[model samples]
Target: MRPNRVSLVMSWLAMLLMGLAGLFGACGVSAASAAEAPIELRQGTVTTTVDGVTRTEPVELSYHWDRQHNGRPGTASFDLPFTLEAEPETPWGIFIPRVGNVFEVQLNDALLQTYGDMKRNNDADYAKAPIYVPVPGKLLRKGDNLLQIRLHADTARLAGLSQVVVGPAASVRNELFESANAWRFTGSVLLMAFSLIVGGIALALWLTQLDVDANGMPRRVAIYFWAALAEFFWAVRMADGLVAEPPLSWGPWGVLMAACYAGWAAASMMFVYHLAGWANERRHRWVRWPVAGVVVGTVLFSALSLQRDEPAWFTAWLAVELVFVAAFVGAFALATLRHPNDDRLLMAGAALVTVAFAARDWLVVRLSDAYGETTWVRYSSVFFGAVLLLIVLRRFRAAAVQARGSVAALAERVAQRERELAATYAELEAAAQVQARTHERERILREMHDGVGSHISSAIRQLQSGQSSSGDLLRTLRDSLDQLKLQIDSIHLPPGDVGALLAAARYRLEPRLASSGIEFEWAVDEVEPVEGLDAHGMRQLQFLLFESISNVLRHAEATVLRFEAGMKGKTVQLRVIDNGKGFDTTRVMPRSLAERSGAIGARLTVESRPGRTVVQLEFD
Candidate 1:
């Protein structure tokens, strides 16, 4: 489970407890009724022993039983309807039970003892006696006196008391201590059982909603559920109050409680680690070290159970557990401080549990009687249940967020793939166009080879077959074939240096210019080396040039035609200028169309000027 899930669950439990606090108020009589509440307020006498001199003063006595007890008064060992006074040289002594729990004593209503010890009066059972203390003389005055005692009930006694007296007396009713014990057992049992039920419900929900195999929820949550169940059973046994045997003495309840607590501690840590995206093998080392120490301590403590009355052993265990709590709280604080967005829910849950458990445990240890009388245990359990609920809800939210991010990322990848596919299709279309042009040029080349070259070969053969006496028909055919071959060669030959190709064409055209009575002026620059043109491109340029010159020579009746060709940047520029009877450009449409379409007479045009026409070509 995610930490947020744990947080949400715990938060819910806390809210529920707050809602149900009224229920606990109806449980039973308050545990504090037996001792402290019986002491009535009264006036008192006191004597102060200062610098070896005795001085008298009047004092007052008053006491309030713990409020949770509904104001029931208790009986003191001494019958307290009477009042007596003692001086500084001789002060009153009072005996109050419910020690080993809590008490505050006063002489003549002046504060004297803050915390007093349990009367060594009980034989190991702690059920045998009441607490007793001697008040010092300095706290007394020589007059009518007042005395007060405030007691918090424990397992030994539930009534609180205070009085002014100077005698050893015992009360007839010993039911106060017995009642306190009974209340503690009942309260602990109910609280434990309720916690188990809550834990079980969470487990059932987790099994259904969480992907345990993929998310590791079963292992994470089962340990806590079972542990809590075991604790609940143990508490049930405790509630039965088996006076003849030790509580949790049989079966594996002790081991189970230890295991449950350990698992809870570990699960809490693991939940945060995974939720905040800091999961790693190394994190277990930090989490498990303290758990292991607890395991060892529990084992050792169990062995020492034969001497369970030793307060040191109990104190040591309590101290060790406190240390574990401290460590876990530190880790919780660190996680919250470092990653609030990711760990906020978890930290909130942990903090709730921490506060609830701490208050409950404090009362159990420091004021066991008060806690037993009050409803703290039930309240703590309810708070924990609500917190866990909050954690579950938040886990669902975080998972949804993660899912959305994954979906968005997947969509972006698909869109990019579609764009790549579209670009690939465009490249294929351009390649198809190039292929179609290649097929057309190949057909043209084939026709020239078969029709023109074959005809020329046939004429030569006819001349040879005619017995060396060729007629004019055969001779004329041979001459025509030669001219055709020359024209075809111009189209067939591979590309050459643009400068040289232009120079050769200019030289050949000069005679034609002379025949036409036109002067040819040529200007060609020293062109830089350039990539060659393909066969189709060469044929196109040659045809354009031939048509343009023919138009000037045949129709223009011009005196001069100027030709220029040169490399300009990456492009080759060519211009043909003629002094001719130029037609209007608008009226030259049919001729320009025929020339571009490769008809016999039409040629591409330049914009017409008053006296000259120019045609230009640019090649990349």
Candidate 2:
């Protein structure tokens, strides 16, 4: 049992030792690989042989041979030693991180690769990215191989070289790809792509959200629209950093990048101002002119700089951009402090982040005199763009909620107004009914006064004077009662129908006419219905016809009475013809009765001579 326990302990010890050896072996291999990585020459000596005089000086990576250092346009050379573990026939490459103007690479005094042409392509400038030149296996020696580079810088604007690495093709390629600048450039490219996509979405939202206010002015979609424009321009500016060779010449490219920067600044200011609601303020008018002036000046200055070939304009433009950044950040900060809302806070934070990254880039360039293109500004811009997009989406959501509420409120108001209108209509109908009854009462009183009352007064006067016989008195009483009955019957006639009025009159007057030893004839043709004959007008018309017939029975001593009503063209003709001892119509027809006939859209005329009497009424 003791021996078995000892064997188990030994087995555990051996297993632990094996695990530790394996771990150490893995670490050793990793260290060896790291040590064998491509050599980056950060420090070098620049040698120039001009007019048989050679000059040498200690230089570092990204060293600028501008007017301050090496004034004249001449060729400068650099030499570095490279060691290889393998034999001569091994594939090797030299990777240049960055180069300005034109350059040539040489291995052991043999031409390897030439970049740019001084005489023909002076305007050609390389991007601050790696350029790989493969060294032929035959040209490369085993140890201490001399790699020489000759640089010709014609311009004072951004002429420099970053580090160069010499190693195997795979190692050099891997180092070049994994460089800090390459990572930054890749990040910028990714951010630009994201910004472009988000900008398109924001622009679509802005366009679809186009709405008008009550005053016929556009709503606040300008904020989102300008934010999208700013993001797009920022993406366009970043595209320059992603490429190894710009599409345009260096001068034109610089001008275009400056223009994009100016556009971004202008749009950013407009977006912030609109978002903060300052655009609706009266003071914005004054603020807008200065903003416009800054943008215009930026564009014009960039153009002039391109034409004059002045590098100082670039510095001025950068200063202007910094100022705009400061101003925007300050504005958003103030708005956040005043409003203290989630949106304002987010905008303020984004603004500060943008400014911080921009300042960091500017300081790095200014202090180091190197264009550190791998700044955090592009990432910060992407972050700001996301924030702005969120704000715009929130605004759209709020507007949608408000719109739904407005529709509900509007529906309620419409229902309330309909109820009010219906109640008002009902009240008006009741008032109209009352007014019609009042008018009818007045009409009845007038008929009684004109027809029945006058006949009764005549009968009373005849009896009191004893100038009338019993038969005459009885006939007057009977005629007065008949006139009263006819007046009451006219009241029951349907309004606006002259035929109904005439028929009613004949029914009432026929009995009286027969009692007076007179033959009555009613010749009423089927005439078209007449309009504009109201209740009062019909009563007046019936009374007039009854009075005419009564006159024939009481005074004219008519043997035959014929009442005729028919249409004559557009006019209604009403005729009461009597065969009786007629009076002089000129003396008998009253002026008041003629005037009343004219008031009722009718013409009245009486013709009486010897035994024939005719009372004619024509209505149009």
Candidate 3:
């Protein structure tokens, strides 16, 4: 759903341009006679035309051998012999592609063109579609001239079909040149357009607010930028000389063209290297060396100011260029076979470049002699370039989408963590509030114990010393002082059951239980309010509970204890029963009663059984 508008538009434009290229390929005339040249003719097809040249006009020059002439596989000769009334001003030429069998062209019954062995299989590729060659302009005389062609279409070459056409040498030559021009110009335009679009998008991305920390660097976009620059220079050379006469100087022009191509190729290869997960350690380093060398060499050659033209140097450069392309292409093919990312569109685009470039170059070389306007080399390159451009654009878009998704996921995780932090902070604040209130209460209790308790003690001392008091009044004053002292010393606990505190105490005493051979168990079903308890009281109760558990373990040698906490009306019940030796509850009862007359005495009921004693305590 994260649509990058730049990538989207780039992808669409590249695709539309590529489609236009394909459509452009399908245009033009496919004539039956020699007037319309054969489209994409091969080796064997060339021989058929050679044989048909012997006969005059109205001759059946068709490759549909299966229809009539028996479907037998063998050499067949046909003729389209022409008789000249006067010497023609324009030179004439015929395009005879290699057919499946051996073929020879004869003018005035003289040998003109011959290819392949008579014994070779008709299934050979060279015989299928060879380049068109021009006939010598001097061959035509004032009188009649016979063109006899011989073709071995069966068992002589690969599946080859031939088309023979005769036209003015100048016109055919121009057409031959035009075909190359078509591919070059068209390819240049497409490449330039794509480069511009991709470059613009990459620049835009570079300018955008990117989540770099989480997403890593956008290396793919960077590669695309370099590729666009390379393609721009590449288009310049091809487009500049497209319609220019003399085809511009080949040396400087070739160097620039080669450099551009190498740059784009290297950039594309690097992009795939990273995109396909092959950009690791040794591989990346190894591939980059050759790419760099090629770019450097191309630039150097482009700048050299040598006036003398060396075709050999250019040819050698081309050979090296081809080798370089092959090396990267081989690596890419292997990568494609191993890749499981399912980026087939990209793979297909790269494959087309391989086939188109290889095929176009091959044809241009073979058909150098009989070159005409309707050549296939020119169209294929430009058209396929456009196709590949579009493919890369689509892949770029996909990468953008993946990046956006990762960003969104990271954002969600961050939000969740923020919420958790906020909740923790809230709990911390509440605990802090409770602590503040407890501190205030503790301060008040300390003041009362120091100030009020002193005054009461002084009053009791005065009364006992016979300072104007009746006996009943003196007794009442003494009881009031005792009550006031008790109240001041007592602590306030939080208004909550003691289950949580008891659980914590037990958790801490587990080690003691283990050493004393005691099994402790506890359960809390309900937690009632501590009606009069406050924070101070809760702290005092916790400390007392710990001290009692310690005494049972140390003095009574308790083996097993059961602690239960539950709600009983408005009071919280906390009980601990232990199996241990019995203690003298009556002896301590009197001392505890004498120590605290107004308060209930600490009560202990010890029941001794066969092997154990039980004692319990309860507080509200």
Q: Backbone clashes per model, in order?
A: 50, 0, 59
List, residue by residue over 360-439, the lDDT tens digit for candidate 1: 56455434433222334334544544555456556656655876887799899999998998899889889988998898
Off by over 4 Å in 3: 1-191, 202-223, 242-257, 301-307, 340-349, 355-359, 362-397, 400-404, 440-620
Off by over 4 Å in 2: 1-260, 274-286, 331-335, 364-375, 396-443, 446-495, 512-620
TM-scores of the models, in the given order?
Answer: 0.33, 0.62, 0.40
Q: List the residue pairs that clash in candidate 2.
A: none
Q: For candidate 2, write residues 1-620 as lDDT tens digits.
A: 99999999999999999999999999977765654556776666788654456789876666655433432345678776666554433466777766766788888899898877745433566545457888787776545667778876543345566677876677776656457545666767887888798789778888787677769988657777887898899889878766545677665676777788778777877878887888778876576776776677877777676566454565566677688669867977987798898888888898888888888876665334563245677778877888988987898888889988988999999999999999998999999999988977876777677677877888999999998998888888887888788777766788767788778777777777777789988888876655787776776677677667767777887789997888899888989999888887656675655766776778888888987888898877
State which candidate has the highest TM-score: 2
Write the residue-wise lDDT of candidate 3 on 101-179 in tens digits.
Answer: 4566777666777665555432222332333456776776655556566655431112333455455656554675345
> Which one wins by lDDT: 1 or 2?
2
Best candidate, lDDT: 2
lDDT by candidate, in order shown: 0.50, 0.74, 0.51
